[model samples]
Target: MTMVRLDDAMVLGMNGAQRRAVREALVVAYPSRGRLEALLDGLDRSLAHYAADQLPLPDAVFAVMAGAKAEGWLPLLLAEAVAVTPDNRQLADVVGDFQVGDFQVGAATTGRAPTTPPSDWAVIGALADEFPDLPAARPLISQAGLPPGRQPAWNVADAETFWSEVHRLLVDGAVVDGWPKVLLAAHRARPANPVLAAAVSAAGATGNPGWREISGRP
Candidate 1:
């Protein structure tokens, strides 16, 4: 494969093979150094490190999200790639703007000429629009979350609600919250689960300042 430099205003499109090839190059040549990049979404590798439990990544989603967040990215691009992953529980378990699995099914069926609307998608949209976006995203957000409502176009209300719900799901652990702080809080709350503590500690890179810092984890 050849390296093609992409710039802002110039969207880069890649077949799965090309994208995989590039990801391989970064993994082999840089070995987690983050030498690769994406001008729009910051870098694909960046999203891979965030440690999302439902994400089917070989890397960590938290690390990726944190890196991109640190780089001041909006996570709009990788959001598309990761939007419909197999494990996208979105928000049902954790709490956010989407339920990944349901969202994907819904998104795939949206505006279809022959397919019926995914039930979950319709439910989520109806719920999100009802209250400025919360409980709905606790399972699924992103364009998939939009469904038949002016989708593919990010709405201002959706974006704001997205961040708000993410803060709850990811940082605050309102819905399952996250592993690190929750682990810490659990420990503080008494009767903590050692398995969980050890699991979190051993699940990813430690001391990340963002997400959790288990060991060489997700």
Candidate 2:
């Protein structure tokens, strides 16, 4: 494998292995203790935000909708914002515009008018450009297998099925809401399955804050 320099910007076109190698190179590229500390701080902040369940949206959604409460669907919107801006402030701005009709979410498919459009890609691209090395974020839900107006059913699915579906969702890098609850429910369903227990523990270690929150871990 070619040891690409950490400074390489050509990573945008590199294969998955190359990208993984480049990320690993960061440790050697910034050898200073101070640099490493700064890097650690940045990683912590980003991971915490990414793993968080409720990303704060603009206060305007409630203001405009008049008692419009956040439903399970709202996290789907926030996940879309997170695909672009992981920071609460930036996410708030994107979501603010989203709520108020300034930022538009386009649908994944075209031909007929979509019930809800996907997150605005132009804005997401602009944000990705500003944030170095940030992979464009995607919604937690997959556009595939979706009916025109229906929501995903993974939320209420049984443990085995939820396990399979959630695994597919994460592997595909799609966003999912209430994953912790799903996991806990799965655990409850298979309390005696040591393999499942181990898998659940490993899932939480992925730096998702919501996992711990729902699992009752620190």
- Report, for every candidate in turn, its global Cα lDDT versus the true structure: 0.31, 0.30
Taking all chains together, each candidate's TM-score versus the true structure is 0.20, 0.22
Tens digits of per-residue lDDT, candidate 1, 33-80, equal: 222223223344433344443332214322453454455542243343
After superposition on all C-alphas, the RMSD of every candidate to the true structure, in Å, is 21.1, 21.4
The best candidate in terms of TM-score: 2
Model 2: number of backbone collisions = 9
| Candidate 1: stretches off by over 4 Å | 1-60, 91-218
lDDT per residue (tens digit) for residues 96-126 in model 2: 3223232323211332232221122221221
Global lDDT for candidate 2? 0.30
Question: Where's the lowest-lDDT run of ten residues in candidate 2?
Answer: 129-138
